[model samples]
Target chain A: MTSILASAEELTGGVCCGASVAVPREASGCAMEAVRALVRRRVRDLTLIAVPQAGFQADLLIGAGCVRQVEAAAVTLGEHGSAPRFRAAVSAGTVEIRDSTCPAIHAGLQAAEKGVPFMPMRGILGSDLALHRDDWHTIENPYGENDPILLLPAITPDVSLFHAPRADREGNVWVGVNRELLTMAHASRETLVTVEAISDESLTSDVRLAAGTIPSLYVSAIAEAPRGAAPVGLPGYYDEDTSHLRRYAELAQTEEGFDRYLAEQVIAAPAPA
Target chain B: MSEAYRPEELLMSVVAGLLEGARHVAVGAISPIPAGGALLARERAAGRMRVSILGSERHTFFTDGGRELFDCAAQGRIDAFFLDGAQIDGSANINLVGIGSYPRSRVRFAGSFGSAYLYFLVPRVILVAHEHSRRTLVDRVDFVSAPGTSPPGVYRPGGPVALVTDRCVFGFDRAAGRFSLSSAHPGQSVGAIRDKTGFEFTLDDAVATTAVPGAAALALLRGSVREALQEAYPEFAEHVLGQAA
Candidate 1:
C-alpha cells in the first residue's frame, strides 16, 4: 500500500519538461520561451494560476487551447489593448474564469507560503469582486470591534513557472526584487524556471545575489533558455518588444487572425524536445 | 489666447494641481495621463515629491513585490493616487469590474487592480475618466469595484477627493456624499456638462473655467516630465508630449 501510494518524483514531475499546463508570470519575467515550448508541445486542459496578473502568456495559452481554467487577477496587454484570446474564451464560455484581485492572490499565496488555511486582508469590503468570489470569505476581526475583513484561502498551485535573469549550475535562481517569484516557488509543489543564461559560478557566491536567490531546494528544474522572456522583456536584459506586441495584439483580435498567428509564429515549427 | 494646449495637457496640469504638496503620489498601471501628471508634480516639487508609477522600474520603490504599495498606503505613506473607472456614480463609487451584473456580465472591463484596497488606505484618490458623458458618469454603477465612502467605524483613510474628466473637474465632498462641479474646460459649458452627466451634482455659484497649462508647465511636461513618463508609458509620451512613441 505504501509503495502504491508513493512515487517519489511523480509529484514533482522529476524535471520540468512539459508544454501547456501552468500559466507563467508577467512581472518576474513571463517565461515566454517556456510558453512557446508549451505551445509547440500542444499540452492541453491546463489549470493556470497567474499569481496576480498575466498578459501574453495567458493569451497565448488560451489561444492555443491549452487552458481549461484560469485563476488570475487580470489578463491584459497594457497599452497595446485587451487580451483578445482571453476575452474571446471568457465570452464564449470556453474557459473557466476565477477572477481575483492582486492583493487577494498575494494573500492566498502568502497563506500557502505560511502553511496556513487562510489569511485575512483589509478592504474588498464593498467591492463587486468580493461579492462574486465565493472562495473568499468575510470574517469579523478577532482583535478589534465588529470589523469585517476578507479572508482569502490558500492557493497552492500544482506547479510554479517563471523566467529569471540567470541561474547557477547549482539550480539556484537569481530573482532580484521579484519577491513574488520566491513566494510562488515556496508555496507551490514544484517550481520550473527558465533562464537567460546558466552562470558557471554559484549565485550564492555573492551576499547580495544570495539574498535574492531561491535555493535549488525549492526549484525542481532549471532549463537554459536564452531570451526566455522575449516580447515581454526581462527587467535587466531587454525592453519589451512593443512592435511585436502590437503586431500580436492586432493579429490576435480575430479568431482567424489568432489562428493564423499561432500557425505562422507559435506552432509553425515544433520546439526542440 | 496664449497658444492653445490640448485637453490632455490641461487635464494633466489639473491633476498636478491636485497633487500640490503631496509627499508621495502613486499612479496605477495603464494610467498614462495620471502618471504624466504625477511626474509633473514631482518636477514642481523639485525632487521633494516621490511618484511611484506601477510597472515602472525607475518609478516604484517597492522591492518586496506587489504588496508594498498596499502596505505603504495603509501606513499612510502614500499621499495621492489615481483611479479610473468604466462607470463612476454621484456618491463616488467607481466601477472597474464590468458592466451589467456580477460573475456574468454584458461587458467586462479590466478587473479591479488595487482600487478596493488603495481606496480605503490612501489619503487622496483622484478619479480620472477620459469620457465624461452620461454613459460614463452614472447615478449608480452596475458594480462597485470600490466605494468612495465607508460607514462610520470602518477604517477608511482614503476616498475620492476630486474627479477630472475630458470636459470638466468635479470635487467630491465625502461628508456630503455627493460631487460638486469645480470647473469646466475652456470650451465646455455648465449646461453641456449637466446634459452629459448621468448623476446629479451640485453646481457652484461661480464655476470657473479650468486653467490652461501655461508656457512653463507646457515646457516641463514636454521636456523633463515627458522624458520620465517614457520609462513607464512610451505611447503616452509620444501621443501627448510629441516624443517618439
Candidate 2:
C-alpha cells in the first residue's frame, strides 16, 4: 500500500543525503515543494538526475548546496538566460557534472524500465559526450555487417519525484501526456509524488484518465500539495510564474544573492496549506 | 521592401526558407525564431507540414513523453530540426558543453540537449547562431558536443545542411566537411563576414544578397505566425514582434 502523506516535508522524509534522485523537466510538472522541503531539511550530497533536462529546480538544488553531482542533458533558465547557480558551481568545481545528451538519458532510464542491463542506441558515435562516459560502451552489431552501436547501462535512481495535477484515492497519479513520469516511476526504486489535489474517485476506473495514470503498483507514496509546481507551470492548472522565475534568476547570480534567496524562499518561507 | 522589418523577422524569414518541403519540423527550447519559422512554413504549406515546438502545449503532439521525439527522429519520422552551440567550427562541429576543457570548464553553456542524436538522425539539421562573431564561429570548438561530420561506415543520414547567422547564410558541404558563403544578409558585406569569422570558408566570386521577405510573407509572419508563436513564446511575441505586428 502507498503511504498518503499530509505535506511535502513528511513525504520528503524518505529522501536522505547522498541519494540519487530523478526529477522531471519544467514542461512536465516539477516537484518544487519537495525540493524546498529537502533544502529546509538541509539535505546534502544528492546526485540529481534530470530526466533529459531541467531548469529552475536543478539550479536551486545546486545553489542550496544540496547536490554533489548533476547528470543531465542541459540546465538553463530558458529565455531568462543561463542558470547562474549551476554555471557558478561548475566554474568553481563544487559539483561534478556527468554531461549527457537528451536521448542517452532516456535510453538509460528506458533500459531500467524494461529491466534490461543495457540498451543500444544510435548517434553519439563521434561525440565527446561518448568519450567522457566510461560506462557507455560501443558494440558491433552481430546481425549487421560492420555496424557499430552505443550501449547505455540502466539508470535506476533511488527516488523519482514529480508534481502532478491529481491522484486518485487508489494512489494512481494522473500524469496526462507527461509519460516521462511513467518511465521515471518504473526506473526508480521508489516513486514519490506531490499533487495539486486528491480525488476520492478511482482514477483507473475512469477510461479517459486511466490511459494517463500511473498505477498504484509503482507509486510508493503521495502528498497533497497545492500549487506544488509553482514558478514552473503545471500545464492546464496554471501558467509559469515567469516574473518570479526571472527574479530568482537575478538573485541566484551570486553566492550571497543565492543564500539570500534560500533564506527568503525556502528556509523562512511559509508552509504550504 | 515596402515595409521595414525587424532583424528577428528577417532571421525568421531565412529560417522559414530553409524549412521548405520539410514534412515534419521540430523546434527545441529557447528557440522563438525557429518556432516562428516553422509556424510560418506550416501556414505556407496550408497545414501540410507538422511543426512540433517543445514545451508548447498547443504546438507539440508528443504524448509518449520526452524520448518520443528522439524515437521519432530515429525512425526517420522527423524531416528537419534546429541546433545551436556556444562554439561552431567551419566543419560544422558544435560545442554546447562549455568554453574551456571538459570537467573543469572556464565558461559552461547549457549541456547538449538532443543535438548529438538529432544531428545524425534528422535529414536537415539547420544550425542557427544569432551571434555571428569570431568567438562563436570558431576555428575549432574546445569540445565537440556533436560533430558536424562523421567518419565513413557510420550510418548517418542527417548532419548540418546550412548555418544561419545574423549577418549571412553559409551552406555546409557534407562531402568536403566545410562551409561556403551562400549569401550575405542585407547591409552585410562578404569582406565584413570574412573579417568577423574565426574559421575559413569557401567564398564564391559572386556572393548574392539574401532575398528580402516579401510583403505577403511579412504579413503572414506578423499576423498569423506571430499570433501562433505567442502560445509558446509570449515574451518574444509581445516584445520582439510588438504592436506593429
Best by TM-score: 2
Q: What are the interface RMSDs of all the models? A: 1.6, 0.7
DockQ each = 0.61, 0.87
| Residue pairs with backbone atoms closer than 3 Å in model 2 (clashes) | none
Clashing pairs in 1: A19-A38
lDDT per residue for candidate 1 within B20-64, as digits (tens), equals 999999998878889888888889898799998897999888999
Off by over 4 Å in 1: A1-25, A271-273, B243-245
Candidate 2 docking: what grade? Answer: high
- The DockQ assigned to candidate 2 is 0.87
What lDDT score goes with residue A247 in model 1?
Answer: 93
Worst 10 residues of 1 chain A by lDDT: A1-10
Residue-wise C-alpha lDDT for candidate 1, range A122-169, written one tens digit per residue = 877877777778888887788999787788999888788788898887
For each candidate, report what fraction of the true interface contacts it reproduces. 0.47, 0.86
**TM-score of chain A considered alone, across all candidate predictions:** 0.89, 0.98
Best candidate, DockQ-wise? 2
